[model samples]
Target: MNSNYHISSFCKIKNNEVSLNGSVIYNNENNNFSAFIKAAYKSLETNYAKFFKMDALSKLAFLAADVLLKNEHLNPEEENNIAIVFSNKASSIDTDRKHQQSIQNKEDYYPSPAVFVYTLPNICIGEISIKYKLFSENSFFIFDAFNAQHLLDNTNSLLSTDKTKKVLCGWVELDGDDYEAFLYLVTNKGSIIHNKQNIVKLYNT
Candidate 1:
């Protein structure tokens, strides 16, 4: 693993608002979750002229990728090492709920394949990769909660292999009535000035 690798920037969205913009650490000033969701839906409407009832995990991943892709410093086309490693606790439970609901009602037993496809947790990765045109290693994991050690371990393993030059990794978790997301753009080239303390300060800010 590249010991030199550090997180450059990250963004998170949840509860209908952006919890963090593209920053090395958390920033409460940008943590209006409801507003973030509104902005994301607006952006999607403007770009795609369509929208779906996306769950918390999907919303968080899409918003994070949007911020990452727009970073002027990162060159996606030139960055062949770019990859995505995301995790969630619920693992598309919202989609499963809808799918089940569709089958529960005999009058509405028609299942939309489009909706069914998103029932998998990794579908969010596919959505982000398609948006970014990233044909690189992608993975998804499920944990009971935000397991920092697991994140670090998995990311280090990926970086160690040198198969990916850069990794976009983080946790996107949602439980009943609660949601949180944390993402990082890890690269060996850039420097990270923020540590845990810095993260706390930024979150308080």
Candidate 2:
């Protein structure tokens, strides 16, 4: 794998906590992922109305991506060349649970297309791609846990491709009131080497 890629910046939201670049930015007393996400959104001043309509999986991914994508180091000239690769343990399981609940019984059956839209794991990437205007390669993977080796390998492979310039890679998982997202921007420039060890260290931090 080419070592040209570097980690520009990263953000982590685990449980009721929020951190950026290994520093704690927000810590909530209550263990509510929704509240924590919205608090971070308001604090960051992300004025996107569509955020409300997104499922928890998309919201988690969008919030983390919003943080990394805002950096000036990201060149708009090659935005389309920026690919997104994400992994998660749940794979939109929280939204799936809700959708299942909505149709569990005929007496209360009211299936929602809105909720159904996010049943697929890749929907979060779709939401992010639409919001950020990324038209290049994008994919989502499901893992038992954050497999640093897989992420590192795929990122390196994508960057090795002549078509891809930079990549937004990370993990997004949510289940009911529990959620965690560790996202990073990998570019040809930055201080930290975009490798497995450092990626795992950043996620752990």
Candidate 3:
């Protein structure tokens, strides 16, 4: 297999702003996560109704993936060749708290199926897969911090094999008001070499 894989493109979303390839493409400092993401969705001008219903974590990942893959071309025939490897410090705790609170109050014990559905961190990955129709392998890892080396290893393992031609990997962490998402598309085509150093550098940028 090919030894040299590159990060074709990367997108960062945080602090009410969205950046592509380390450049700020969208910004709205006045709103919180919910409003900011809704504005970002409107900016895309693509109608995906389910976006509004998704929990905070899902929305964050979905928007980042949308920005990363919006202009990139993918073969529909080879949909199964694309893989998603995502990691986060907090695994859907934002929604987990909501689910927990919903049932904790005995008098107002109203368990919400919608909120319960997104309690799994991997659900964000599933949302992205459904949008792109990618049927390949997908994994969500929970790390104490941004483990770039681990991410690099996971990505390399997939690309090193013939099973996957491209992998969308990154750190997407969201906890309450504090949130950050960095997603990159990795493949054999691109200028930036996909290595541990570069991954950490790009993620910081």
Q: Is candidate 2 or candidate 3 better by lDDT?
A: 3
Model 2 TM-score? Answer: 0.92
Residue 121 C-alpha lDDT in model 3 = 97
Where does candidate 3 stray beyond 4 Å? 1-3, 75-80, 106-110
- Clashing pairs for model 2 are none
Model 2 weakest lDDT span, ten residues long: 71-80
TM-score: model 1 vs. ground truth:
0.75
lDDT of 2 by residue, 1-205 (tens): 6788899889888867667777777777767777777887788776789998999888888988887787544554554567999998888788888889878854766788888888998988887787677988888999999999998988888888765888889998888887889999898999999988899889877
Model 3 lDDT on a 0 to 1 scale: 0.87
- Candidate 1 regions exceeding 4 Å error are 19-36, 41-56, 72-80, 107-109, 175-177, 193-205
C-alpha lDDT (0 to 100) for residue 199 of candidate 1: 37
As a whole number from 0 to 100, the lDDT of residue 103 in candidate 3 is: 91
Residue pairs with backbone atoms closer than 3 Å in model 3 (clashes): none
Top-scoring candidate (lDDT): 3
Taking the tens digit of each residue's C-alpha lDDT, what string does model 3 give over 1-205? Answer: 2348999999999888998898898899855788888888898664689998899999999999988877586553455468999999889999999999989965776788988999999999988888788878899999999998888888888877766888999999998868899999999989898888889899876
lDDT of 1 by residue, 1-205 (tens): 3457677666665434453354332233334554455556565442432224555557667766766656635454653457888887788886788778777765756887767877888877776776566777889998876665666666667777877767788877754446666677777655563244333433333
Of the two candidates 1 and 2, the one with more favorable lDDT, higher being better, is 2
